[model samples]
Target: MLSAVLLSVLAVAGQEPPRDCARPNGHLETVACYGERREQVEADQRVILSRINARLDQLPAEGGVNPQQAKQSLEQAQSHWAAFVAADCRAGEALFGEGAAFALDSLDCEITHYQARNRQLAAFEARYGGA
Candidate 1:
């Protein structure tokens, strides 16, 4: 009986306690880290979207842009944003213990990235003649 009890205690002890992302210092640190990464992603998206939009604006109303070129530029920007977001989210999860704040912050970063990208595309269309 004693041996069984000892084994049970050992098993429980071997399991690590859940991490608390809400702890004062940890919570603050996590938020700051997420914020920094989010800002970077947002900035990059802004640049891409601005360029795309500028290009689009230059296009003629009668015919649409060159499907191939527009598609290629869009795909490139999207892929970059997606990868950045994914990596950021993963890092947040790892560092923040999947807390609600962490999730929301990460999502905000993604939204910002998309919005910026859209604007960038518009800017790009304006700068260069669109197909």
Candidate 2:
């Protein structure tokens, strides 16, 4: 199944995810995969936010919202989003109790949240990013 695909990936024309990370060696490695995913998503989101923040600094105030106020609002939204992700993931982990799956579930939840947030940020840039 997954093992066969992982083994054959190197022989195929296209590249594939690393065998250990894709299939995972154990629960620990399985959790590590989520960590890697979270890192990638967060890194992407950071770049987007940085660009938006820079734009905010350069642009003139819009409507009643000044650049500084907009940045502060963004900061607050980001902080609230982070808190929600943490609390929700902790709740998910609680459902699984003391087991290897609990940690994996929590990490998976965080990755899902972060990925969704990344998409939202990208869409924001696409809509509002001025040249």
Candidate 3:
């Protein structure tokens, strides 16, 4: 009986407790870190999309974009964005909880906005040379 109780106590002590994402410094750091990383990813996406758009826009209307080249650029952008999002989501889950609604929502929103910007840039490029 004593051995059983001791074993139970040890097991409980050995288990890692969940992190509280609400602690002042920790929570703030978590939020800030995610924000910074998300911003960096957004910046990179913007650079690529901007270049692609500028190129598209520069092409004469009579000699529009090569469909294959456009498709490849889009695929590359999407792959990069997907990788960034996966990494971000993993970090968020580790900092917050698996079911952290707010953190997940914020991350999704950031990605969504970035994608929208990318689309807009593509449209701009299609209209003008990628300058």
Candidate 4:
């Protein structure tokens, strides 16, 4: 199960997902599909973040507004956000209990958070003059 999820993440990062997960027929497939979608969103977020960071790099340094400091802050925020997502998923798993649906609930939690983060990164990219 863990392997499948990891594969899905790696697959989406390097290439297209093996299948369209928008409509999965069973629990196993749904998990894989959600992993794919989550990773896809994550990949998109990385691109947007990179672009924004680059733009930040080009800004001239001013008193109390250092571009390097801004970049570091973004990096720290993203790392903390990732940790929060993992912990949040664990909380969801606990709420769902140890049942057949436990894994699904956790995956759903991850997917929801991934989508939200992607939206935030995308909006930031747009605000920074779109990329």
Model 1, 51: alpha-carbon shift in Å?
Answer: 13
Candidates arranged by TM-score, highest first: 2, 4, 1, 3
Report the number of clashing residue pairs per model.
27, 0, 10, 0
Candidate 1 lDDT for residue 127: 59
Pairs in clash, predicted candidate 4: none
lDDT of 3: 0.55
Per-prediction TM-score to the true structure, in the order listed: 0.41, 0.78, 0.37, 0.76
Candidate 1 lDDT by residue in tens digits, 60-119:
555664745665677786788678866765676566565556554555555565666556
Worst 10 residues of 4 by lDDT: 1-10
Q: What is the clash tally of candidate 2?
A: 0
lDDT (CA) per prediction: 0.55, 0.73, 0.55, 0.73
Deviation in angstroms for 103 in model 3? Answer: 3.9
**What are the runs in model 4 whose C-alpha is more than 4 Å off?**
1-22, 128-131
Candidate 1's C-alpha runs over 4 A off are 1-70, 129-131
User: For model 3, how does the per-residue alpha-carbon lDDT over 12-56 read when each residue is reduced to its tens digit?
Assistant: 556445434455245434544445445665786768665765565
The sequence of per-residue lDDT tens digits that candidate 2 reaches over residues 47-73 is 999998888888788677588987898
Off by over 4 Å in 3: 1-25, 63-101, 112-131
Error of 4 at 110 (Å): 1.1
